[model samples]
Target: MTTTQGLGELTAAERFRSRPLTRLQRIQRLLHKHPEISPLVVLVIASFAFQLASDRFLTASNMSLILQQVSIIGALAVGQTLVILTAGIDLSVGALMIFVSMVMGSLAGNVGLPGALALLVGFAIGMLAGLINGVLVAVVRLPPFITTLGTLSVFTALALLMSHGTSIQGDDLGSVLTFTSVPVAIGPFQLTVGVILMIAMYLALGYCLNWTSWGRHVYAVGSDEDASRLAGVRTRRVLLSVYVAAGLLVALSAWVLIGRNNAATTSAAVDANLDSITAVVIGGTSLFGGRGRLTGTFIGALTVGVFRNGLSLARVDVLYQTLAIGILIIAAVALDQWIRRTGAQR
Candidate 1:
């Protein structure tokens, strides 16, 4: 009986080891193991294709322009990435940013507060807004989509009321508010301070996500909240912290927005909330949560900028540019679904 059992176990092991991965399975496994790889590939292909279509697309000036254009969306995506990683979404990001920018502008331009102090207050309010969202989702057990959707309307109304539907011009906002617009030359590329700041945020957030204990908890909570809670992870606290962190990033993005647009207006980046989500999705971060990288988000944002700029350079119609992006978004989500299935099968 013992000899028969041993032989059976050996055969089972051999069969398992002999199971071969098909080509599609191999691709799925590669993407499952490294979610960022697919987006990186897409970015490379898009860049090469655009460069081929328009020589200007590869020029240093145009490259710098793309980085500049993507800065606000990229920064917003950083916060969105954190929220989505926890299986949540923040439709209020753009509204919160505009609200914060309006407050910052009013404090400095109208209330006579110093720009730096106004910025600090804006940051505090941003965290407070995030805290409210966190409380609703983490403590009250409301769905993330619903909570953010409600806040989106609330924040938008508040912004309009605060600004009285007026824009704060960059001239009245003082140098401090617009400092991110300052240009810096590096060899052949001309990048703004806002672009550099956005890049720094990515590097810092990437390090934290990959190397820190809190980051691990974030992934755990997003992966399986019940399992993580059973494992002694503070799942609720992780969720709360993620929203607050997202808020802080949104506040920072407001500064970049002001610098980029040279104004604080409620009308600026009306599509930013969706744009951030698009960047996150295109970057290979699973909407179902807990499987993504900031690098992918960065690349995704750049890809959007590239597509618009490239299409324009190629003299494609504006509507076609948007259609191209829509297609990319759909493709990214489909790819994500396929990758998620791989994990389910395993």
Candidate 2:
């Protein structure tokens, strides 16, 4: 055969080689395409491992308790996910929640406002906090980290000032403020309105992120802000909106906090900012941005609860649990780096 014909025939044969990939290869490709899958797998494995380690870990009542414990953190993580998706971070989310809750407490309990009005005011405060962060980051061109860090201190101080460092607890709190504690049974599990609210937020956000044009723009901005701007995306507007949305979520978390803690304490959710960020990272949301899923965040929140609950059931100390969480955070980041490298190589 002529050299050209021989080469062409060989190329045709190569194209016709339709061997299927092995199961491991298929799994790796699937994981690469969907970063959230790894976290889900980890969550399931952790649950099973905990179940084996402790008899109480697998009980329906214990699972319900875990959900309740994670609900507030999960709510905060929702907003955190949006900020991180835009290649931004908000250290002020927990502080925002506390400040808003304090507003709710002061308005309803001290100022004699109706419970409903107090709730609205609380939401407004949360939105305002978000707006400040947005303006600083999007309009003033400040780094998100710096903006939120500054706002974190500001919001915390505001909460303390507003509450005077005292928790609001009295008959003055209306049914609206206490509604989060009202429980309803679902099959074998009992759940509170707060937990339901947390789940609903995830469902709504999952749809928004996966299906909306705005969501696409968010990912685009995170992936490459300059390119997204060149493609006619309103990068600043998107960033602002994301921050605002995150603020709204934080307010909702405050509401849940009231329901969970049964009081609007200034110290409520003090660790939420770190916990939310940890859940985002461990849930397989890329800290570098442009890749993640709310479902993963949901699982990540549950995973944290599981770890704490399981460890307690297993007779581990609180200090050890904290250390374990720290270790998990480091391991998750390491895994994230490995996944990114492998995907890049692929």
Cα error, candidate 2, residue 340 (Å):
1.5
Q: State the local distance difference test value for candidate 1.
A: 0.92
For residues 34-150, could you state the per-residue lDDT of candidate 1 as single tens digits? 988988898889889998998888999999999999999999999999999998889999999999999999999889889999899999989999999999999999999999999
Best by TM-score: 1
Candidate 2 per-residue lDDT, tens place, 187-288, comes to 989999999999999999888898999999999999889999999999999999999899999999999999998988987678888999999988888888
Q: Give the TM-score (vs. native) of candidate 2.
A: 0.92
lDDT of each: 0.92, 0.88
Query: For every model shown, what is its TM-score relative to the native structure?
Result: 0.96, 0.92
Off by over 4 Å in 2: 1-28
